[model samples]
Target: MTTRELPMTVPSEGLPARVRIHEVGPRDGLQNEKGTVPTAVKAEFVRRLAAAGLTTIEATSFVHPEWVPQLADAEQLFPLVAGLPVALPVLVPNERGLDRALSLGASRIAVFASATESFAKANLNRTVDEALAMFEPVVARARAAGAHVRGYLSMCFGDPWEGPVPVPQVVRVCKALTDMGCDELSLGDTIGVATPGHVGALLTALAGAGVPAPVIGVHFHDTYGQALANTYAALQHGVTTVDASAGGLGGCPYARSATGNLATEDLVWMLRGLGIDSGVDLGRLTATSVWMAGQLGRPSPSRTVRALSQQQEQ
Candidate 1:
């Protein structure tokens, strides 16, 4: 506990007092890796994240093994961390995925959707409407079973094939998700092309379309170094939930241009500096990321992790 290890607190106006970070490293981060991550390592990763004070960690996805070989051991991984006293949400692509998750006592689930047709087809092999049609029953069944469902809307700002996506288009899909009983909506910047103004405009449009800020989570990527900036904009609009990966370890397997997610350490550092409470222990979280980096045989992409780890070594 040294002064150099933590940032100075400076409270900002019009921001939520506390933010809920939806940690997505295990599922979203490791899904795109070239090497296969073992189920034991994945379980330990989730355990370390929970120990580091991440209350809502995305454990794994129950998608077909043929689709994501890295998470093919979802059944094995989920059982390892199922007893953790935190929210562990897994991705369910369809009814079959939901069945696999529900059979294992998964109480929180997420369904991935797209704001553009190209990503919907590329990632899910279905048109935008078709993907929604597929998820309708999944959401309903999850809700009926008392499981919290999160709807992930990718390419909310821009898409590689569709270019700049319209705000109205994103809002429409978001409304559909909310209408289908999704407890929360995660707005994703799939390719990390969003700017601050664009972030504000979209939040305004969603609000105008009857989507409130409390149920909205911002998921940004650092491909263009705008993830933190866009997140700040979302915070200004009353967004309290954010999707980040431990050590910035994720990219879109379907979209080549999409890069790593907003790092949890980076976001926690910014939140600490802004005097916003995220309920994460910065030192422990940074150490967990550093450990995961070793498991992956690489340095962490998170600037906060590098800087803080260097300070600790010194």
Candidate 2:
């Protein structure tokens, strides 16, 4: 079968005129590392991200230490970032997490759910329904405490354990989160198994389900190296918010061979090349990624970085 090619132009109406990029490197990115990143370095990392024109950043997860010992200093991390002008959003897995986030004066929190039942149980230790039930009170408490909540529906495209997740399951979880007062819902392509066609079809289905485009964000992984294409597809369907990591620093520990998120530098590169104004300084952003790679003791995984670094070397 011949694949139909679509124009890659950003639609004036379909795509939100301006999009927001939420940097998740400091929290989600570093959380997957083997060694703990010092709280001061994490704080500085966030400061640099904000300086690079990232308006929203996922600061840390407020879950129990046993689950993510890397973020045990969330209380200190969030407060240390209070001085930044950008919005610092933390991930809260339950009511207890919400309480901890509230105590740290978090103005925004993100909750996560999975589209596949098996991944949900394995990742969150609960069924999909049970996980949603757990988040309802956390959402309520967050709102009652005057904080905005964002929901993340992970494994929307494909799961490591279960392949090719049904679109209806993703829509249902998104509906539940929006109904529970989540101000925004981010659809995560957890294992990066999504294609442009999959991205378009899913967005179309969500639109048909009456989920407003403005309230939806797309989070893509680069595992199969198709994240940028999928991101373009999402933009064509009117998504205005995207969750990306600086230098492609995070990946699913549960999903074997899964790569990090769509790199912020690469995304900025594409957005700028397409004449979309992301308001991010590419040079500064690349420098920040370089610094992060140094801290992590790994070479940058971004293809754009590799190309640019190679050119500099030449």
Candidate 3:
């Protein structure tokens, strides 16, 4: 296979030369799987991902099994990763979830909130303000306990229940999360309805709100086939970090129309093409995606990987 490399010069937007790609396939990707993936398989999946040059991986969410039965083994799954040399982040909705994550020795944790009131009430059983308030204590306690915290501002683009999300709401939620001392904030296009224009405007608003650039990341789903485009827009606005999944493993269970996240292989391919170093091997990443697809008994949704593999076959 011929390797295509991008130039070393930085892009015009002055975005950072390299970015940290957060792999969420282990948790967010697997949580919606109807068929139970054995705990051993989940562990091995993460192991393969780590070998693929993923430094920050979301291991699992510590939510109750009643809510998401797929990730019920988070407690056991987390402790077993004692030897892995990477940042293992777990999503904790509230104090109970935080307790479970901390007990499992999670060094980094993510607390999430939605910008829309309806989505927040449905997803978190609280209003927008109420949800933010809940995480305050959780963040403070997590910080006091010496654990790093990241915040997820969901529905940054559009909401299923509510219509388009306003930039002020997104900015307010992000500022609150950052003010809570979250190490970073991941702006999520939960329903994947954001265009580059919307992403640029929202990011500009957040920057105007005095948030630091390096502390922001983008989580996009390919629902409208715009995940990669939105990511490029975010980059053009000077945002660095990004969240992706291998094989596009996870789609939104709540929003059935939503596609899986931006595939890590595709994201890496574009970044490498643009001379943006992600420090990930696209070939190895695709091989892992194929292995994962086999394990799940499904085909990968990465266009670049599928095309590359097919060309190689010919």
TM-score against truth, every candidate: 0.99, 0.94, 0.95
- State candidate 1's TM-score: 0.99
Total colliding residue pairs, candidate 2: 0
Clashes of each: 0, 0, 0
Can you tell me which runs of candidate 1 are displaced by over 4 Å?
none
* Per-residue accuracy of model 3 over 83-131 as CA lDDT, tens digit each: 6988899999999999988876777989988888988877788999999
Candidate 1 RMSD to the real structure: 0.6
Report the lDDT of model 2 for residue 5: 16
lDDT of 2 by residue, 1-314 (tens): 01121114443444555779988898779888999999999999999888989999899999888888988898888888887988999999888888888887889989988898988888898999999998899999899999989999989999878899888888898888899899999999988999999898889999999898789999999988899999988898888898899998898766765789999988987886576778887767777888888888889898776766665566
Which candidate number has the best lDDT? 1
Worst lDDT 10-window in candidate 3: 3-12
* Top-scoring candidate (TM-score): 1
**Model 3 lDDT, residue 71, Cα:** 93
Candidate 3 or 1, higher TM-score: 1
Q: Which pairs in model 1 have colliding backbones?
A: none
Residue-level lDDT for 273 in candidate 2 = 56
